[model samples]
Target chain A: MSEIHALSAGLALDASVIGGKAHGLVALMRLGLPVPPGFVIPTAACRVFLETGGLPGGELAGAVRELEAVTGRRFGDPARPLLVSVRSGAAVSMPGMMDTLLNVSSTGDLRAAVREVFASWTAPRAVTYRELHDIPHDQGTAVVVQAMVLGDRDDHSGSGVAFSRDPSTGERRPYGDVLFRSQGDAVVSGTVPTLPLDALATREPAVWVGLMDALDRVERHFRDVCHVEFTVESGRLWLLQVRPGGLSGRAAVRVAVDLVDEGLIDRATAVRRITPGHLRAAAVPRIRAAAPPLPSPDPASQDSATWDRAGSGSAMQAFPGSDPPSTGSSRPVTEVGSAASSGLEILARGRGAGPGVATGRVAVTADGAVRMAAAGPVILVRPHTSPLDLHGLAAAAGIVTTTGGLTSHAAVVARSMGKPAVVGATGLTVRTHDVVVNGRSIPDGAAADADADADADHMATDGHSTSEGTTGNDQTATDGRSTPEGTTGNNQTATDGRTTLGITATDTDQVVMDGWSIPEGTVITIDGTGGEIVLGVAETAAGDTGPHVDRLLRWAAEESVA
Target chain B: MTDLTVLHTLRCMGFTDLGRVASAAGLAPEEAESRLIDLAVEGLVTRVPGAFGGWGLTEAGKAEDARLAAEELDKAGARAAVTSAYTDFMVLNPELLDLSTAWHLRTVDGVAAVNDHTDAAYDARVLARFADLDRRVSPVCAALTAALPRFGSYRRRLSAALARGDLAETTESYHNVWFQLHEDLLVTLGIPR
Candidate 1:
């Protein structure tokens, strides 16, 4: 009991001993959430392990026995083997910088896995993370060993990461990524693209209800926003991890204001929960919604037709600088331009990472991006980024990753740089120079080749001179070749000597002017809040600074005056 | 300098001026420039024409670098050691990106904003951690260099970057150097990034 805390309802352990993650897990268990049965080898055990290079001598075996009893499965058995995950939980969270040994068992004497986790506390990256975050290196990480619920074991199984609300807009609903028949790793790594969290409602309704209930309970208990990682095994939900209060910027402000109204927390606490950092982030305008504007962005009120409208906008929705036009709400999806005979060309849609609008020439490779950026703003599109793409990412105006998700390296870097980014745009093929999106080749008109040249010349002449952005850096050309009835296929040439240039918008709500076969250098705007990458510039209004933001700031003003 | 050295330098830098390529390759600018010309003639390198133009590898050059890098690894009998170092590097990669991000933006009030570099205190803290990271990776770089001599340039380049407090996102800045070095490792190991 002194060295290990069994994860059950009423054990009050501080974060320093059990670490932030384990502390959160304990909270989840106490709240009656469906957390997997496990015991935490406290940070005290980790400290001793660090000094002696050994695990808390007998705590691991005893904990495993208890886990076995709770899960009703034998560890390392050939038949129905009980696999468990060992994760490092430091007092401070340094994500993606530590080791996790999953599927550990007794045959390897579990102690080795325990030691590995302990030793990982000082692995080069983890050490750097602590130093950067001002965390004391001496504070070790607690290892939480829990029985693994196989997310990929059956048809009704899955894994997902859910936020109490949309991290992008602070919308009060369970929003997250769900991977069916896969493990938690896919959900975290974002390498394998996942479905919207709502997909769970249809696939495994019971797990979905349990997850929704768990998110609600966690929000009520924390009195702030939170997210959780969970696995559904054969229709059974098992919560793996939970952390509270990660909403930022506008989302953070809205959540605080909403919570106060919901009477979860007092106005003073709500004001305190939001900081000036969140205000600045909120001030950053998001891409206007692509789906025809609903009364509000209520996912419940949305339908397949809404996505069709959002995805079908083929023309310029709004002019640049002036509040871009909104796609009028009355349009039906079936009446999309005659070109919509093929499945709607989704130019590119991904999980929006950082919030803002940017339009630029698409650069498929880092070299092309850096070179293209010198001429004008470049949207760096990649299958996925590695450390190598840093220079190109820096040079570009916005970032697009066909792979990776919110926490991927690209997402983290993009947010840090305050660059608008769209990630995990599935089915996007960055074909050398041309991009194939939503399974359609683009820019199939010979007339547009000469027009594209004229447009480029115009942009080169006018974009810098007439463009009125405060940043003084957006010289991205926004001309897509119109009148698209020409040769279509790979390497198709034109009537003229030049090749075809495609222009398309990177947006959520598709308007009429937008067409399937866009030319290159077509400027598309990426909205981080609405998670919309609109063609041309989507309208951007000032931050609503409405009741929620105003109340939060008023509380701030009142506190300062006090 | 050998043609492979010139071609690989261009490969690592992505697109860069002659001065940096020479420095990265440990050759005089003239030596690198002369070899680059020969590479261009061989269709392994191309000079982009524009304000942003620099000597860079063509597709042929990248294919050539991969051929020679794989050859170099096989000939030296160091694929196992280099591959092992790569595994360790991947572990550190995310944290490095995290550090770069912390440098680029900081949470102010409640929003993420660009770090204006006005806060010497904050910048210093980030730099100190960067130095600490560099210190830990030194041995890994040393191990790779011992296995493959070409990797020695990375340590020299990174150490020079660390000695200076310059970690900006410019083309030749410390972060970009580390980025190029990371690419060099992957290219040498024949791994797609």
Candidate 2:
């Protein structure tokens, strides 16, 4: 049997044979979308290569000849070279754990790239990801070789990933990041800041319109919210990939309901789509400010002392009673409203990997975290975590990494420990003794000793003895009873109460540097449910699913009655 | 050079107790303690006194360990071989971490809940995968041992952890041992963690 198959509308094969990516490309072709022309080397070919460690030499050369003819350019012909991207695509999506080589022009390099992509299926990270996700070990990945559509071809060129609806909030709007005059890899790496997807509308209007149309058509075709990776080569749009339905939790529910409202899917289908896991995740407590921003607290009256006292009082009142049993649907809005009134300014945002709320001081290193934990609760902030940081993870009240998604090691460990974690906060940078968030540098340890001492003096005048003014020393007093006034009485579980109070009491350092820098000892509350990192302590309210979930469930009930 | 076995072992294991440092170094606790005391007197290591405290390398100890590790690699003429083995080790590193994380957390009903180890079948599946990974990693360990004999201790400790079913959580678990081996590779290759 032939090991190669052209990725076209007429190609009919199971994902097991062609791999999910090839299958999706064929689907996009079938929908009349502008998918870059490509061909797939089936998984069986990879299996053979794995067994014999040799490519089907004649067949690969013949396939290249056919691709050259189709693209009207010769391979390795520098005058009009036909470069292709060689990518790994298993039946299952093992995102970011496999290899992909781009801009290969020579036949030898192309063959080598294809071999590498096939071999990446068993790459240790890929193997572990498969093992964790229950993907079969023996099902080797297929190789997809597509003619390159260079996003860096011109000023009008760009690459981006777009969701048909907002992946975070499930709003019916295109949401994604775009990098102009760069390849898709640059966009995915998060090394360079990207403009909003709307930037394409102004710069390359035709490509933007085409992308929107493609998104609409795919959503209709799949009957679900879709994510697409697209590239514009000199203003001509080419879709590199498309996948349906990876929206999770609240976003998933919102998309399902929105789809029903749009007549793309029925209510029964919407009900069937959301699982118990989605319901559970949707019910996790989120900071009230994560939704539409509450009116900013009046800056003129926002004195640190007054704000702390007011915030403390409101937090206690926010959770006056035991948490109401979660029903996976609506909750009383009054609780959320009361918590939202605290008016905490958000420092940064990222994907919520763990569920709950945690407030603590930031520690840039694991050892720093361990040292800081003795004085008060600490949040271990790192560029990324390794096994070496395990101890720091253990000692921290919560965790934050400037990079990595929910499936990253730091996120997994945070969830394992039941600690609130925010990951992929790309705007944050970790340094040796400090962290820079956005443009503000927040010093830690010895760098912040001067500020801590000054804050201690400020606290003394207020008659609060929470600050020891000796943050530089390892022998900072651990007296829990000296908790700062108006920082206690929150309904945090008894197990967390001591650390929570300790963190709040010790975070007496006033924000310096034009109220931009939040020093190491400064208090910050993180909402793992909503991915919000807020300055100061903010009360968490159980994620209010708004009306979409209630409406979807109501439809399900009606469908069952019928 | 003075024997840096216990010191190097402690350096890789991060902060840990004497028992674990001894076990990883393939020495008795008393022998490890003697070495540790000797090293501490030189201001290379320190014993932290607290609930979370243990014996850890001081800044000077870490620098000394790195210098010694590089010296050992060069003296043995195993830099190229060890570097190649380190490359192979990195491929298995992520899988080990994934397994460790899986042992600690499982997705039930789509939410990441703590594994709790109640579901025997789930635990068995994870353990089986660990064993499978261990089998695959044997060659990499073998390559490393051939390059440097001290690397053999990792192979022994990893198998022991698997045999004892201490996959994660414990200080002597397979995850911890694997983690130390990763650190050793970086230290030997002069690669930054």
Candidate 3:
């Protein structure tokens, strides 16, 4: 068979031939790991499609013909149909930057679909992403046409993504969100809220067992913490894609060290793998515990339930201030007493880039945020923050963005500003009156409550009345700030009455401050390096957590033994 | 029946000084202020004190607006058209925000820096995008106005904001107008912030 037609065991082809995503898939296949049955249309075809202003005739036809021949189902047949996911896999992963059509129903239009996917490789948005990321424009994408594995096939079926370990803490165990009776796109799009990966153990024990076995095989094959996108159909497990080496910081360090200990790689190679970028990334604070709080039974845990209730509380209390009375936790509760006040909210889940959770009134606009510094601690939520958001960013206690990745502008700014940040949270809406938190709606200006009032009061008594925390220029409303800042900046000045300092507690662990009793589930972080409040303490010190990190390192080492 | 002349028009005006509110509601300032004071008496609206303050709807005012807007939408039977228009509004919303961000910040050496208003060329590029986005938004606004005549003021006010933005330095410029329009959508759709 011609090299292009070969389905397996072919030498590594350039991304141009197999496309970036499929090329990686082929590499995994070469390593003897399970991959869903699939085929690729070379970038040469895409280049031709773009130049000729349509799909190159014979290449797409040939590729589709081969796909149907292998899948044993007619394309777009409706019954026993061969559905496929057409993805834009450029050399660099520009997630959500390009278009991906899933469960495409037409096999006859497969060629046109491939061309469409190719054309999207240079859509205005995609072009802009490439410019922002400094990715060269001319390197066209290769299209991957894979026979779709139905994640929602039956009771035993579902779709999910799993990292051989926790990507957040680099702890070894299958870690990722899973949605029953859904497809890969649903998991990635985050439109449908997902359940904890552990739910699979009870919901579909057989599938969960199969998934663990597959993970073990893939981890042993990659000799690294590998992330997989998979689906189970009618009790059958199918792996769609596998990737290695996305862990960063402490997780990366721990993974590398463990790999050496397991004899999968030498100590020198492990040392080499810990790049300076990884070290710098590691230095960014994270939730210290490796294992996420065992997915709690709080109603907030269900993604759909939370989304259906989207924006309900943003107006009344968008901030859910870090120390606000816990709505769902077993803690002293304070009735905010107004329908206008949005109850506490879960902003979407990401890799937890920074190690803390905070609550502050959300500032949707940069100007509004600039003005907000005096009123209260503001959480700057945006589709994504640019250089313009810096003023708001400077004033915000936390930042949440709907667009961009770890390397996006918002993440960089949040890190630079030394604020708690969550980025790449999909389905985010930042309207003037409300902002969507984790798919839930919250009313605007609803966060002006007793908590913020107290924070304002606390700041004033501490003499940072200059700071103006959200009580609207009234120096007297600075009631809460004094209590929250008791052991830190506020108390230090209270006793001496001569301290010229502003914001006394700079320590990361002490971000909750000494006297302010932290409510259960409120995220807090302390920067060990700059002594600044990072996010939640869980996030800031995540790397130091033993269970999640140590377990991952140990697992990677054990996999290497196999 | 819903009052197109009253609630729907004010929904898009947001918190504004008397003159702008009156202009948005197509009433004289004295007339608009009288109605506003009456609404304030009902606890549906309030006149904020000081230079930075303005006439703003209370939480009750927002609820009332949402209830009345939905009724007006149903009365005119413009829900589908308005919903479609709202989707179109959503499309334009992001572009508007991008323009706003560009007005405030710029990029250099892969770093986001303040726009500083020194770069006329960059400012013009962003403004051009805004203009493009505005052109696309016109049809949707027109559709909305056709469904309810009260929405006609948005076309005028939006154009006014853009024109001022193009001609001179105005702090409450195009972005501010767009922000109000966005607020108008949430109120109209009864989607909380």
Q: Which one is best on lDDT?
A: 2
Candidate 1 chain B, poorest ten consecutive residues by summed lDDT: B105-114
* Alpha-carbon deviation at A143 in model 3, angstroms: 1.8
Cα error, residue B11 of model 3, in Å, equals 4.5
Instruction: Provide all candidates' interface root-mean-square deviations.
Output: 8.5, 9.0, 11.8
Q: Which lDDT tens digits does candidate 1 get at residues A97-145?
A: 6678888767365778888888888777677656655679998888888
Which sequence of candidate numbers ranks them by DockQ, best first?
1, 2, 3
DockQ of 3: 0.04
Show where candidate 2 strays beyond 4 Å. Answer: A10-17, A43-63, A115-141, A187-195, A199-206, A290-344, A351-353, A386-391, A404-409, A412-416, A439-516, A529-531, A543-545, B1-3, B26-34, B105-118
Model 2 pairs in collision: none
In model 3, what lDDT does residue B145 have? 88
TM-score for each prediction? 0.77, 0.77, 0.59
Candidate 3: residue A334 lDDT (0-100): 18
lDDT tens digits, residue span A400-468, model 2? 776655556677668767788877654454433334344222222221332233322321211122333
Where does model 1 exceed 4 Å of error? A78-80, A289-356, A365-377, A385-396, A404-427, A432-519, A527-532, A541-544, A558-562, B73-88, B108-111, B144-148
Query: Candidate 2: lDDT over CA atoms?
Result: 0.67
TM-score, first chain, each model = 0.71, 0.72, 0.60
- Candidate 1 chain A — worst ten consecutive residues by lDDT sum? A317-326
Pick out the ten consecutive residues of candidate 2 chain A with the lowest summed lDDT: A306-315
How do the residues A314-343 of candidate 3 rate in per-residue lDDT, one tens digit apiece? Answer: 110111110100001000111112101323
Looking at model 1, residue B146 earns an lDDT score of 95
